[model samples]
Target: GFKIGGAEVSRKHAGFIVNTGHATARDVLDLIAHVKRVVKAKLGVELETEIRVIGDL
Candidate 1:
């Protein structure tokens, strides 16, 4: 069990993730992986990210 690299999944929304403080990219990645694992195990759903390229949506 790791410390999640200083990042955490948002309590207000399941689809959102947030930083604890001075977080690094590794923190966010770790938290995202954890969330995906939990969701897959508990809900039987596989999640993927649809990251925006930049300005356009």
Candidate 2:
């Protein structure tokens, strides 16, 4: 699921690497970052993660 401009997004073509539960924000963020880097390098298109990261350092 994703939201844009404060509205729920219903598009299906977007790529999302979701956390499979029991994952901390840090874990998800790290995975998202890695995906962005890899996808950009391999496909030449920049992908953004839709999750918001918050809480503790």
Which predicted model would earn the best TM-score? 1
Clashes of 1: 0
Counted clashes in each candidate structure: 0, 0
Structural RMSD, model 1: 5.0
Instruction: Give the alpha carbon lDDT tens digit for every residue of 1-57 in model 2.
Output: 443222322255436444444555555566566667777999998975566656664
Alpha carbon lDDT of each predicted model: 0.72, 0.55
| Deviation (Å) of 51 in candidate 1 | 2.7
lDDT of 2: 0.55
C-alpha TM-score for every candidate: 0.71, 0.53
Please provide, for model 1 over 1-57, each residue's C-alpha lDDT reduced to its tens digit, 9 standing for 90 to 100: 234767777778767777778767767766777878988999999998755334421
